[model samples]
Every structure is written in C-alpha cells, then in structure tokens.
Target: MPIEVKNELGKIQVMNEVIATLAGSAALECYGLVGMASRNQFKDGIAELLGRENLRRGVEVRHEKDRTEIDLYIIVSYGTKISVVAQNVQAKVKYVMNEVIGLQVNTVNIFVQGVRVA
Candidate 1:
C-alpha cells in the first residue's frame, strides 16, 4: 500500500489577512471607539467559536491587484462627534495601511452603524 498526497487548487486570494488585521486594529485605536460589536452579539460569538479568522464583522477588505479598499462600520460612544471620530479613523487607517502594509488604498469608507450610551 502506498500513501499519496493531493494538492489543493483554485484558491481565490480575495484579500491579504495582514492588511485586514491592521485595518481592524487601526480602526479600533481611534478615539471614542466603543468597540466592534455585531448587530447580534450571540451570532458573532458563535462565528468566532467556529474559527472565523476575521472576527471584526463590520470591517471588510476589498482587494485589487495593486490597491486595497477598506470599509469600516462602527458604533461611536454617546456624545462624541461622529464627524471627528470618522475622520480620525480614516486618517489613521489609511496611514497604517499604506505605511505598514505597503499597499495603496483607493478609499476608506466609514459607516456610522450605531451610537452607544455611556
């Protein structure tokens, strides 16, 4: 009897994990960032238990050959200016993604998903 190994194929490299992680971390680092929470926390927790690599549900990475796009959906702390927070997030995320990941980001889209009370 002989043991044989099969090679896997057709893996679509949609986005770079490092860049995605950096993006998520950067977004969270912004001032007045409450946290990344799912609309349904229970479902999100289950997804994590199932070994989903991208734990931050509201963040997304759209990859291209030469550039990457970032989308961040966030909940701001109550009484914080949404505009200021969003601007900070955009600047920080863009800077980190470009300097650290060495990838050109076409855009950083910030979506104000919700506001959390203190």
Candidate 2:
C-alpha cells in the first residue's frame, strides 16, 4: 500500500528566528559587544535547548506590506562607550540585513540591555 502525504501551503510570516540570528551575528561582529540574551530566557527552558533562540530575542522584527521594523537589545563590554557601540551595532546590522536579507528595514531601534564586566 502506498501512503499519500498532504501538502499544506502556509503563508510564511517574517521569521523571528531569522531576524534574531541576523541581529545576533551583526552585534557579535562589533568590537564592544560582549554578549546578548533574550527576555524569553526566563520563561522556559528555551535558553538551554535552543541557545540561538535566546540570542534572537535581542532582535524584534515587525513585518508589514512595504517595510520591516527591527529592534535590537544588546550587551556591551564594560569599558566600551555605549553611544559608539550602539551606533556601530545599528550600522552593521542595518547594512547586513539590507545587503544580505534584502529586506527594506523601516527602522532599527537599539537597546542597551547590560554591560559585561569582562
């Protein structure tokens, strides 16, 4: 007997995972970024199982018909200047997302979550 599989066509919403991964990778590229963690980490065991997801919380993407909005939360090294670090992060992330993902980003919001002593 042959089994038939049903294919469901699903509307793909802008993947939060992809956004997070991009943001995390961009932030890490900066010299001052020490680490990042998502607010979701406190909720479940998600951080332990899916470490990448935890990093993705640093980025929030709101998709619209014409554009996408991105919000980033990050941690910087204690000695780094917050303003400069934030600017670097914004620039890098925007460039990467625009060039690599080819998404029209409407805005990039940067939030400094913490400063890592080390």
lDDT score at residue 69, model 1, on the 0-100 scale? 71
**Candidate 2 Cα errors over 4 Å, as ranges:** 1-14, 40-53
- Relative to the true structure, candidate 2 reaches a TM of 0.72
Top of the candidates by TM-score:
2
Worst 10 residues of 1 by lDDT: 44-53
lDDT string, candidate 2, 1-118, tens digits = 1112223654334456776688778878898887665644433432222245466766777766666677877777889899999899888888987676556577888877666678
40-105, model 1: which lDDT tens digit per residue? 344433311111344456677775555567787777888999999999999999998667644567
Candidate achieving the largest lDDT: 2
Residue pairs in candidate 1 whose N, alpha carbon or C atoms collide under 3 angstroms: none
Minimal lDDT window, size 10, model 2: 1-10
Candidate 1 runs further than 4 Å off: 1-15, 39-55
